[model samples]
Target: MDHREIVTSLSQEQRDHLTAKSDLPGLPLLLSHWGTILVLGTLIALKVPFWPWLMIPQGILIVFLFTLLHETIHQTAFRTAWLNEAVARSASFMLALPADWFRYFHFAHHRFTQDPDKDPELAFAKPATPWQYALHVSGLPVWRGHVKTLAVNALGRCRDGFVPPKGHSKVRMEARAMIAAYAVILILCVYFRTPVLLFAWILPALIGQPFLRLYLLAEHGRCPYVANMLENSRTTLTNILVRRLAWNMPYHAEHHAYPGVPFHRLPEFHALIEGHLRQVEKGYARFHARYLSELKLASRDASK
Candidate 1:
């Protein structure tokens, strides 16, 4: 969206809220934030039996909260606007995504999600013709990885900013605040002399990022689209791992099609739309078996 599209002047009509979808009863969704803190605290306090298994639950909860925060970033999950922004940014830092930068590009992603020329996040997708596969094969610390996520925010804080399809002065201001925050984080790392492996770099990228990217990739990865949101995103079915870790985010299509529906209410929304989804395709799956299989075929083709 262009700067003109940001809609900063919330007119009388604009302030109106989305209608509630059902009376299946609203949930105490604010509890989700507390739940995240509880898990993070438990992990640090009980730092015993340091194993991948021990981290599984804690890391999963981190990812779940992160995803929920993502929806909040869109201003869809909750009634309280500032509360939604706070929840989104806090969870974003926990996930290592720059909330400032995320807010900038995410607005674009929503407006031009499927448009090959428009979406920033999907620059790694097929439309962007990226070398991410090569980067993946070479390894994770892709020097470019940091830049890819930060680039727009960097430019936007400049005079013209980047090609924001929406918002203008306020968007530029948010971008600047985020850059300042980034500096503060680095200062904290330097003061403690935290090892690159400990605080400066590795843990955030390694422990949390792959999970973040996996969550992102699954949303639109290799999935065929239907007539609407029901086909644009994937739903990982009834897997508890998917639900707890991604905050029921696997029901992505439902969430997008009906953004007013809170995360707690997504299952209800899904039930309402499931029939429409199945009729379009066979629904969705979480395994990366297709990615694995595609890489093998691509390797063969490249060798030929």
Candidate 2:
């Protein structure tokens, strides 16, 4: 069934229960996420034994804030509107993504998911060959894209179709503000003559982005370009830790099917519609394995 049909199939009571929002669940999760980042950063700052290695996990946690940013843009991360706005702005700064701009881009992605001609995500081609996949996952392109978007928007040259004309000013202002903030940060880092920010934030985010890339690819990679959300999005069956890190975004198909359902309640939503999911993966590892195998097969066929 299509997304609307699936929602319509649910009883009113079930629908109401699933869509209920509360701030309690999200607050603790946000706090714990930030707390973990703080602990890791402190260890790295203190230069504890094997401190360099700590950046790996540190980076993972930092980059995964993209998931938090994603949730906030949808305003489903918390019931409180101001909380969502505040968190979205902070996460966006950490990721070098402008929240106001991303909201428009992401909403358009949902509106035309997997549509080759329209989806802004489709503007960047997915990696097809092994070498291409390596470069893609290296996180280089993502960083480049973020930088380019920020620069262009700040210059008031953002011609992205998804961002409305009225929003152009807001997007421009947001990008300019982010650039100024980054400048201030860089000046402070230089004046202090310390690499604290470098080791604590920059390096970790760089090292951790590939993992995020891998995780995000599983969402719609190789899924069919169809109208049905269940068919178009792949829901990866991941472990509890990964689920928690990503704010249960692993239940992507459920989220796409019913965008109103908050992050905290995705598990229950998944249970209610588990049987209907068409592109479910057993795990991220399995998904990547199958994806690579298919890519190899396709390459061989093309060469023949």
Candidate 3:
């Protein structure tokens, strides 16, 4: 069946059922999310015998909060609007991403998933060479982009075509507030002469960012420039733990297809669209290997 046929086959009742938002699983999910962080934090605070080893998991968890941020931007993380906003702001702050700015930026991404010129995400396409891939995976470029975005937006220089003029004030205010908050944290760290922030936030994020970059690259990395979500996006078959951590984002084609279907309901949506999906990968590892192999072949062909 074609994409439109697959979408039209679903009755209104089924659509409503899939789109119905609720907090049924969100509460427990949030608990588990924070619980993991608390456990890692406590272990770090106590300086346990193997505390250093804990950093890997801690950093992974910390950087993976970007998934939560992405979910909140869709306002699908919780049934309650305020809960979504609160979590979005918190996750944005932790990741140094501006929530207001990201909402529009991400919406643009959803609107134009793979449009070479229109999709802001396509501004920096996936790496086609080994050196480019190495740099892309390093997460340094992402950090630099975020810093520049925040600084410019804070200066009331919001020029992104996707961001509405009416929302520019909010974007500027959010950036300025974020800068102030970071300043306060820095001041507190200096006054207390403590490395708490370093161990707790900075170092962990730095260590964990590359993993996030690797995971994100598979989303639409090698997909063709097409309007069909099922074709342009990729759905990765990953383990339950990774699914939970990513808030079921591994079903990415399902997401780009019907973004209104909340995180809790994506698996059901996937079941509906599974046969119609054109881009499914077994796992991130397999996806990466295939992507690199193809890039290498392309490089050799170009040289020839």
**What TM-score does structure 1 among the candidates reach?**
0.68
Number of backbone collisions per candidate: 6, 1, 0
The number of the candidate with the highest TM-score is 2
User: What local distance difference test score does each model get?
Assistant: 0.54, 0.94, 0.89
lDDT tens string, model 1, 72-143? 776655657776778787766555456655666666666655555666655655422135543443325432
Candidate 2: stretches off by over 4 Å: none
**Per-residue CA lDDT of candidate 2, range 52-81, in tens?**
999999999999999999999999999999
Q: Write the per-residue lDDT of candidate 3 for residues 198-293, one digit (tens) a residue.
A: 886788888889999989999999899998888999999999999999999999998988889899999999988898899999999999999889
Candidates in order, TM-scores: namely 0.68, 0.99, 0.97
Instruction: Kindly give the stretch of ten consecutive residues in candidate 2 with the minimal lDDT sum.
Output: 124-133
Worst 10 residues of 1 by lDDT: 1-10
Q: Is candidate 2 or candidate 3 better by TM-score?
A: 2
Which pairs of residues collide in candidate 1? 1-165, 1-166, 2-165, 2-166, 6-167, 156-161
